[model samples]
Target: MIELRGVHKAFGANQVLRGVDLVVPRGESMVVIGGSGTGKSVALKCILGLVHPDAGTILVDGQDVTGTDRESFLARFGMLFQGGALFDSLSVWQNVAFRLQRGAQRRSPVQAREIAVEKLRRVGLKPEVADLYPAELSGGMQKRVGLARAIADDPEIIFFDEPTTGLDPIMAGVINELIREIVVEMGATAMTITHDMTSVRAIADNVAMLHDGVIKWTGPVARMDASGDPYLDQFIHGRAEGPIEAVR
Candidate 1:
């Protein structure tokens, strides 16, 4: 239920997003894949209104994102940051219930904790773990905690920024599975920015390859391998020689 039409953004002389066009259908997972500095994150930030585009439009369910009531508009979305991004001083439950304890979704402390425990359970964390701090958890556990926080408010849309970063292959696999399951379970519209092909394969219903600040290809995940686009092919194969120039 999100669409970007000819979106363009640039910082001084450095053009980050150049006429990006993308669409994310409701209740489906859309993964945007690209190498570093290809504007994947900039596109996301534009959609979220964190960065205003210099040209074109971003619409969510048909309304331009720039005109919405900031708080209410943002309440409809949840985010799982690239890093775990947990507060060192906060307990696990507190972190999970962060959104629930403030703004429009405010809940009583007890109610928030109850929901936090339930969300933690969904992410495979025990209630006892809620009393512990982020430093006490493994990277995998920390990511799970971030996932729990993302869904704690039962948002209609979720944004995952490099969901499988900084984890081992096995841990990354677990996180990917969790992301897929959670999106399906919540029926939430998901847009994820990640270069991780494993994450793309596991979590995407559709894939969009961002290269040179634009979408090089967009199609169903099933059609990705056969899409025959040089940019996407190079990215998915991690090829050193292709249209995408690898830095020396």
Candidate 2:
């Protein structure tokens, strides 16, 4: 569903991405794993057209993203940010129904609220919680709300940015399971960027390791451990001693 070929991006003197090539198939989950500053997020932004690449092309369903209309291009995607990124001023329902209440798919306020409640339920949130504010919810609840918003539009492509960042292990597991189930249920193409090995294992069908501004390794998640690539091994195993330099 998505492809990036020979992509390159740099900020002044600091080069972040160089020749990043990736493919994400329809109705499948692709996880990009890398240490901090490896340009995983930049690659995502490039695909979304948030950060224009200096070189190469990004294609979505065979259409170059550069040529696609912005409003309609973005309409097909949903994103769950690393931080819950909810609007504190808006009530929970409003936040979830954000996209529903605006743009090409705009709905009546009442209709938007109803869909918001339904999506909240799908993410294991109670209807009553919809009236509360984001600040009132716990970290786990906030993440769930963010998830409900992501799927509110029934988006064709979903991008998960560090989905399990702030939660405890159990809550992280819950979010991971929710993401996995929702992607399967919606049959949506998913691309996630995370450093958490546990999350990668739970959410990824295929894995790509980005190191030194390029894809160092790529393959099925099932083959991650024995793929015999030093970078992938060092990353998945969390070893201080290996090809990856530990930030000190």
Candidate 3:
């Protein structure tokens, strides 16, 4: 459903993306794995148009993303940022329904709240948590709220950035399972960037490992173990020594 070809980006003296080419098929979950400075997030930003690419093309369902209508194009996507990024002042339900309460896809206040509640429930949150603010919730609850918000619009495509970054292992596992379930149930095309192997195993139908600003390896998740790419082996095994320099 999504494709990037010869994508490149640079910042002043820092060349981030050399050339990134990737494809995420419709209704499948594709997880990207990489080291800290491999430009994984930059690749995502390029696809989202938050950071313009210096060259190459990005297509969503065969339509060039650059030529698409901004509002309508964005309405089809949902994002779960690494930090949850919930508004501090809004109640949980309001945060979840924020997209639905404004712009072209706006809904009635009552309808928005009802949809929010249902999404929260889908993410394993309770109705009682709706009125609470971000400050009132635990990290896990906050992540669930973020997940609830991402799926609130029932978007056809969802992007997850470091989804298990801050939570404890058990909670991270829960989030992983929730992500897997949501993607399958919603039939959404998912692209996730995470270093967590467990999350990759749980949420990905396919995996791509980014190294030196480009895809070093990509295949069905089940084939990862025998891919024979040194970089992929180093990353998946968390090896201290390999083709990838650990000093960086």
- Using TM-score as the measure, the top candidate is 3
Clashes of 3: 0
Question: What TM value does model 2 have?
Answer: 0.98
Q: Scored by Cα lDDT, where does model 2 land?
A: 0.96
Clashing pairs in 2: none
Candidate 1 displacement at residue 143 in angstroms: 0.9
> What is the TM-score ranking, best to worst?
3, 2, 1
Which one wins by lDDT: 2 or 3?
A: 2
- Per-residue lDDT over 51-105 for candidate 1, one digit per residue giving the tens place of the 0 to 100 score: 9999999999999999989888899999898888999999999999999999865
Give the per-residue lDDT digits (tens) of candidate 2, residues 37-125. 89999999999998999999999999999998999999999999888899999999999999999987799999999999999999999
Lowest lDDT sum, 10 consecutive residues, model 3, at 12-21
Query: Clashing pairs in model 3?
Result: none
Q: Can you rank all candidates by lDDT, best first?
A: 2, 3, 1
lDDT, model 2, position 45 = 92
Clash pairs, model 1 backbone:
none
Poorest 10 consecutive residues by lDDT, candidate 1 = 239-248
lDDT of 3 by residue, 31-100 (tens): 9999987898999988898999999999999999999998899999999988899999999999999999
Once model 1 is optimally superposed onto the true structure by TM-score, how far is the C-alpha of residue 186 displaced, in angstroms? 0.8
lDDT of 1: 0.93
